[model samples]
Each structure stands twice: as C-alpha cells, then as structure tokens.
Target: MIHHHPDSNMMLEYASGSLNWAHSLVVSAHIQLCPKCAAQMKLLNGIGGTLLAASEPVTAAPTPADSFERLMARIEEDTDASPAAQQVGERQTTAARTRSRKAKRDPIFASVPPVVEKLLSTNPVLPWRRLSKGLKEARLTTGQNRHEVAFHRIAPGSKVAEHDHRGKEITMVLYGSFSDAEGVYSTGDFLVREPGEVHRPTATQNQECLCLSVVEAPVALTGFWGKLINPFLSIRPS
Candidate 1:
C-alpha cells in the first residue's frame, strides 16, 4: 500500500499538463501502481473536462476535413520522399522497443508502467554503477531536461549513504520497500525530499527495492565520505 503521494498542487500540475516530461513520466508510473491516486486522477480529469466544456470553444480553427487532408498530404509527401528511410526507421524502433530483457518474464520488472517501459526499451538493465555496497544506479533519459532521472536498486537490508538534496527529489517505489527517516515507502509510494533535508534509506530485508528517482539537482552527502566526493557530483541544467 502507498503511504506517501505527491501534494495536491503537483497532482494539479500533472492533471493540467504543466509538469515537465521527465517528472511526469515518474508520476505517471506511480499513478499506475497506486489505485488511490489513479482514482483521484480520474476525478481531476473529469473536473478539467467540465471546466473546458464551460469555456468558449475555438471557432476560428480549421475544419476536421481540412486538417485531415493537410495531415494526409504531409504524411504522403514524407513517405514518398524517403520510403526506404522510413522503413529502416520503423525497423530500428521496433528493435529498440523489443530489446527489454526482463520486462516480459521477470516478475519484479514485468509490472513496469508503459511510461517507464518506454525508457527501459532503450536504456537496458546492465552496466549499473555500483555506487556503494549493495547499491547500484542506472540513469534513464527522458530527453535533455533539467531533471536527472534514474533507477536505484538496493539489496535487502542494505543502507544507502546519508545525503541531502540540493533541489527537490521525487522518488516512486516501483518494487519492494525502503525505509528512511520519514517512514517506510512500499511499492507505489511517491515521496518528495526537499532541499537540505537529510535521510538515509535502507531496503527491507524481505526483498530488494527498486525505485524510480527524479532529481532537479545533484544530492550532497552528509557523511564524511559523501563530503569528499560531493564536489564531483554536479548537474548542468539545460
């Protein structure tokens, strides 16, 4: 069960389409695993629809037939200009999407939502950087954005390095559970850590924990060793 969730304001942004793509991707994944949030999202969507219906409609836009013709003409022009190129592009896309290793058979990862599955289609699961004992990280890309997104996997009963965020960091528990100063975040829990807040997360002993994390800036370590290497961690915001 999820014990934590994004605040009302963030959810409002997500429902209204104001959140950035990177954070939106993680939030969407959390909403998939969390029925409570999913229900709330449905309500929010309905409210948005109601508001839109009450507003004045755009009467100056092109007609459906005109838009359809223009869209079809553009597609035909592109296809005619590079049929072979389009075919090759489609093939490459198919291969990339099918490249997921454990997403199909592995129970731990099989439940990944489509938003995250798309990223894994190209990122792969290997080559994880063993940042610390029993902890590994694999960065995922959601275009060139201000936020840095990644998957953090922690072995059972292992504790992560104590650290504080330089900017807001949102984490969604994808599998298993992890506990920090605030509380234990089980599967589907979405929690936010603000700048200067300190916490050390430790995975539950039953199973390993996998979390999707989105950080606006690099984290600063609170421990001695963390202090030494903190200088090397930096985010070049785009």
Candidate 2:
C-alpha cells in the first residue's frame, strides 16, 4: 500500500494541468498506482468540466471557412507524405503502447504506469551507470529546463550519500522499499524533498529498490566523500 502521496497543492496543480511536463508525468504514474489519488483526480476532472460548461462563450471566434481551409492545407501536406513511412511510425507507436499496457498488468512492474512504461520503452536497453558501489542511475531526457528525471537502483541494504537539495526533489518508489531519517517508504510512495532538506536514503535488507526521481537542481552533499564526488554525481538530462 502507498503510505506517502503528493501534497494536496501538487495534486491540485496536476488536476488543473498547471504542473510542468516532468512533474505531471511523475504524478500521472503515481496516480495509476494509487487509488486514492486516482479518485481525487477524477473528482477534480469532473469539477473542471463543470466549470468549463458554466463559463461564458467567447464573443468572437475564428470562422469555420478559415478552419476548413487550414484543415485542407494540412491534408494536402499529409497527402504528399509517404504512406509507408506513416504506417511504420503508426505501427511502432501502437506496439509500444500495447507493450506498455501489458507491462503495467504484470506483477513485477505493477506500480509502473503506461505513460512511464511508454517513455522507458523509447530506450529499451537503458545503460545504467554506477553512481557508487551499490547505486546506479539512468537519466531520461525530459526536454525541460532546471529539472531532470531519472531512474535509480539501490542494492539491498545500501545507503545513498547524505545530501541536501539545492532546489526541489521528488521521488516515487517503484519497487521494493527504502528508508530515510524521516521514515521508511515502500512501493508506490511519493516523497518530496525541498531545498535545505537533508537525508540519507538506505534500501531495505530484503530486496533491491528502484525509484523514479525528479530534481529541479543539483544536490549538495553533506560528507567529505560525498563532497568529493558531488560534482560527478549531479543528475543531468540525457
């Protein structure tokens, strides 16, 4: 069961489509694993729809003829495109989505949502690089500034270097469990750490832990060794 979740404000932002793309993606994945958040999102969506329906109509809008002309021009451009190439692209996208859906149903990755799976599918063989003896990470390209998303794997009973965030950091446990100074976090837990918050995360003894993490800025290590490697350990976009 999920013991942690995104704060109410974050959830509200996600529901209202106010979150950044990277943050939204992580929240979306968490919603799939969390029934409570999913229900909350549903309620928010309903509220949004109601508000939209009650809103006043625009005084003026683009003419239908202009829209039709633009549509026709787009169709003409598409007609000039290669059908075979389009078919191949469509097939690849469909296959990836199907595979992602199937993966979500599997027990091994039950916490992984379709969106996360689909994004990871783009790079089937992720080259996980070692951050430390027992810690490894694989960065994901999110095309966003001042933030990054990545997957991190920690060996059982291993502890990450103690550090304090320079900005904001969010971590979602995807597999196994880990613990920090605050508390122990299990699968599906959404943890948020802000600038000036410091903690050392250690994986549980029973199994390895995998987490999807997003950080807005590089972290500042607290120890001598951590400080020595902090520059190299900084998370970067792929």
Candidate 3:
C-alpha cells in the first residue's frame, strides 16, 4: 500500500488542469502506480465537472481563447466515459500539459511509468550524472524555469547527504524503499519538503531506490562538501 500522497488541494488543482506541468508529472506517475490515488482522481474529476457545470463561466469582454477553449474542451468530455478507459487516460492529460516546447535541455532507464519514459525520450540520451558516491540523477527539461526536475537513483544501502531545501522539493518514489528522518517511503509514496526542512534519506539495504523529484529551487546541502556545492547548485534552464 502507498504511504504518502499529494494533498487534496493539489489533487484538485491537478484534476482541474490548473497545476503546473512539472509537479503534475510527479502526481501523474504516482496516480498510475497507486490504485487508491487513481480512484481519488476519478472522484475529483467528477466533482470538478459537476461544479463547473453548475457554476457560471466568466464572460469578460476579453476572454482568452485558450482559456475558453480549455473550458469548452473539458465540458465536451463524454460524461459516459468508461472507468477502465478513464483509468488508462489518467496520465494522458498530464502528458498533454507537459507539451510545451523547451527553449533548451533506468533498468532504472527501464521500468518507469510510460508517461515518464515518453517525456524523457524526447530529449537526447543522457548518461546518468552522478551526484555523490551512491546517488545519480537523470535530468528532465520540464518547461518551467524555477522547477528543476529529475529522476534520482540511490544504490542499495546508500545514504543521500543530509540537506535542507532552498525552496519546495517534492519527491515520489518509483521503486524500492528509503527512510528519512521523517519516515520510510516506499513505491508510490509522495513527499514534500518546504524551505529549511532537513532530512537525510538512506536507501534500504535490500534494494536500490529510485525516485522522481521536482524542486522549486536548488537544495542547500548541509555539510562541508554540501556547502561547497550549494553555491553552484542553481536551477537549470528549461
């Protein structure tokens, strides 16, 4: 069973198509992996449609075409879509949201969710960039300037250096389990860290840990090497 998940507000935003693409990808992957979250998404989608149907639309003189098109597009979704089919399409909208053109920029490159594989494939093949002894990252150019997104893999029994966030950081485990000072997160777990929050995460000795991360800003690593690296750690351009 999954132990952590995005909050209700985050789920609502994702359901309503208002969430940013970067974070939405994390949530999208989580929903695909967790049946419980996927079910919640269906519920939220229904509630959103009902509320939207009952509410009045803004008829401002300069109503944006894209906004109006989105509203009409959502309103046009077949009310009778099958549960099985809807389940399959859960991540499709997310894939669409991430469709913007980027200005720039495995084994665990295998076995990830299809959406993840699809998005990462759009960029050139990149060698896994080692961040520390046991931690390696594969970056993704998700069109946002502030959010730096990537997949991180930790070798079994390895510990990521302790660190605090400069801005918000959200992590979703895709495989195996890892424990932080807060708790142990397993597959499908969603974690969020706010500015100044600190923790050290260690991959369980039993298996390698792989995760997807979306950071609003770079992290402020906590020790000697971390401090040395912090000044140079800036969000990469999308």
TM of each candidate vs. truth:
0.78, 0.78, 0.77
Q: Which window of 10 residues has the lowest lDDT sum in candidate 1?
A: 63-72
- Separately for all candidates shown, the number of backbone clashes (residues 3 or more apart, or on different chains) is 0, 0, 2
What shift in Å separates residue 152 of candidate 1 from its native position after superposition? 0.3
Clashes of 1: 0
Error of 2 at 94 (Å): 6.4
lDDT of 2: 0.77
Tens digits of per-residue lDDT, candidate 2, 1-238, equal: 8989999999988876667666776787899899999999999999988997999976655543344335334444433344555687776776676566557553445547655665555545666899888899888764445568888999999999888898898999999999998999988899999899999999999798989988988888897876686777565653
Model 3 clash pairs are: 106-109, 106-110
Evaluation by lDDT, superior candidate among 2 and 3: 2
For model 3, the stretches where C-alpha displacement exceeds 4 angstroms are 59-106
Task: For candidate 2, give the lDDT of residue 237.
Answer: 53
Residue 123, model 1, lDDT: 59
Error of 2 at 166 (Å): 0.5
lDDT of 1 by residue, 58-162 (tens): 766554334334533553443233455568777666555455455354466777775666566555554478989989987764444577888899999999989
